[model samples]
Target: FKQAETSFNEALRIDPAFVAASAGKAELLEWQGEYSQGMSLLQPLLAAQTDDPAVLTVYARLLRRTGDAGKGMDVLQPLAESGRVSGAPLRQVRFTLGDLSDQLRRYDEAFCWYKLARQYRPNTFSAAAHRRFIDDLLLRFDSKSTQQLNRSGNNSTQPIFIVGMPRSGTSLTEQILAAHPDVFAAGERSHIGRIVQQIAPLRNPTRAVLARHAHAYLNGLGDSSRAAQRFTDKMPLNFLYLGWIAQLFPKARIVWCRRDPRDTGLSCFTTNFIDPALAFSDELEDIALYSNSCVELMAHWQNTLDLTIFELQYESLVREPESILRELLSVLEL
Candidate 1:
């Protein structure tokens, strides 16, 4: 971490106006939970590079984190307005402005900005492609196949995968679980997805090959995970890879988090999910369709798999965190 900071600082010293270096430094600080430090560095650069959108975004976020949401909104409003007029701003720029508005309690304006942000993005969710994949996987991993194939995976119950749609309280669930002494919080990672991709080309992987896949998945968890009895991968998209996870970690607990479909769609559309692959979230209809597909898939899993899925609803969680958390811990056997 210190080495990275030093390298970033050196790059800035060499070329003070380097936007990439400045953004990299800011990101490094933010990742380390140093919002104020990042803001302090970015704030000065904004005066020199007055029209730099990247600097402005980081500065605005820091301002919001430091309780200067009004100032943050002030910084972003012009950029958002300019982007609207010229159609020049990236989705992130518009999204940051919307977030700032949200922070200032301007719900309506924030929602308007969020919609605009969606317009700026180009990717559309393919409902047909998603449905085809789901149907195909359901056919392949029927109850009988799951019983035969899943038995070959590693028997360790060390991984706890929290799968759900975006903005459906997966992070909150992970946080609550991480509070337990035996649990570790592994933030949203594509380990399981990567495993699926690696093994996808195999026609019928032998038990030895399946064992290798399981080990590779566990190995990817990193050294930090070794300290706890179980660690969580709270990637919401992991909901799509539940069958693979179930096969690899039969004893691993899978928590399916949900929110009211309308609220879930609204939240998904409003939030700026960074992944380019999650572009479906930028459009209302697309996000609604994708979320609905998730609902369908979860239902199919419930009916077909012998797995005991633990459902966590967002509304229930916020209303009764204690009861929900107690039940969550009990489900995890912690």
Candidate 2:
């Protein structure tokens, strides 16, 4: 974030009228959860660049974050309908509109905008390829193989992996857990994905390799509070690497967040995720296929892998937060 801010500032110093750099800075503030500061920066930019899709999109997102979805709708609706914007900018505008509509409970309008956004950025997610990948994981990491891998794993109970489909309440689950005095919420870490990429084709992973990767993952967590008994990695897509996680930290707690697939799919569709791995979220069919594949893989992990997995239902969490959270913490021994 510091490097990005420095780059944006340098660009602005060179060209003060660099609207893209200014917009980038404002967007960075939004990501940092500084809605008020982001809004202050964007308000002037929006006034000057009223028709600029980049400025308008960031401004609309800030408005939405500030509970002004109606105002956000008013701000973006005209630009979106003007057909003046195309490509990535248009897609962003449409997705922001979808988010605002969804926030306002205009479900049909939200879905329409989301569908339009997908048309702009076409995703080439092959379900067959994803299924094959999942099949390979299941075949390679069976009961016997995982048993051998477990012997070489780190015994640290500090790591808590919260895994599930995107928009499936992983963040909510993490927040609930992080509130505990003994737990530290690390948000979403891409360490596992990076490690898996480094050690690809895990058909016959050696014990030494598994041990080295496990150490690397723990080291990646860096320094946490000494008082923190558990640190969470709430990457929803980490469901893909649960088998590896089990082999890395056999004592680690896995919280599997489950939500109604329809709700999860709708949320994924409405939100504009910057991660390219989330390209599956572009199309509803792809989203459904990916969600089902994740479900299938998780079932295999639960059946074949010897790891503690606590299933936390989204509906249950929201409806009975206290009781459900108590049960969750108890399961994790927090």
Candidate 3:
């Protein structure tokens, strides 16, 4: 975080009115959950860069997060309706407006905006290819195949992965676990997926290749992980790469968070992911289909692997946090 702050500061020092620098700093603050500070940073830039899609989107999101949804909606609706932007920026504005409308209980308007957002965004998610890949994965990683799988990496159980569908309590799960003295919170790492993309297609990736990739991932866990007993990688979509995770770190833990499917669907549909990786979340039926696919994949993992894939139900965890926390921590025996 110091590195991020220093970089942003240096950029701003070089040119105080640099919109990119301001937005980057504000985004860093938002990622750290410093909502008010993020809002303060973004508010000034909105006027300066009124048509800057990045600034407008981040500023509006901060406004919404800071309990100023009306203001946020006001800020986004004009740009979204202007038709002055296309591609990703237009999708962002529509999505932000959808989120603000959802918060305001304007469900019909929210749905309209969300649908438009999804339609306008690039079609990066290929359901057919994804299903074929997952099906092949299940076939390839069954009991016998997994037993013979390359177990050539470090055996250290220093990492705990939290994974599930978007809006499935992954963030909450990470927060509670990281609150413990022994746990370090390493927010979403896309490199894990990149590693899986690199290795999953191989007929057999050698041990050296696997070790190098695993080390690269571990290095991204950040400095706090060095002193902590267990660090979390709470990238929800990592559920898609469970086979690689199981193979790479056979002894490490994977915490799979679950929530009511309808609830998760609604939540995901209403929220703006601002990430292409979660393109499935943009559409309701798509998220549902993807969630069901995840269920099938998880069942495969549970039935086939000997790894500790703890299932944390969303409703139960929040309703009985103490009891749930006790049970959760017991898994680590921390």
Residue 96, model 1: Cα distance from true site in angstroms? 2.1
Q: Which one is best on lDDT?
A: 2
Cα RMSD of predicted structure 1: 3.1
Which pairs in model 1 have colliding backbones? none
**For residues 202-238, could you state the per-residue lDDT of candidate 2 as single tens digits?**
6556778878988877777777834589999998898
Best by TM-score: 2
Per-residue lDDT tens digits for candidate 3, residues 225-286, read 98999988898988888888877787889899999999999888767676877777766667
lDDT of 3: 0.84
- The predictions' CA RMSDs to the true structure, in order, are 3.1, 2.7, 3.0
Sorted by TM-score, highest first, which candidate order results?
A: 2, 1, 3
lDDT (0 to 1) per candidate: 0.79, 0.86, 0.84
How big is the positional error of residue 306 in model 2, measured in Å on the Cα after superposition? 1.1
**TM match of model 1 to true structure:** 0.86
RMSD to native, candidate 3: 3.0
| Model 1 stretches with alpha carbons more than 4 Å out | 1-7, 13-20, 23-36, 46-49, 66-70, 81-89, 201-204
Can you list the residue pairs that collide in candidate 2?
Answer: none
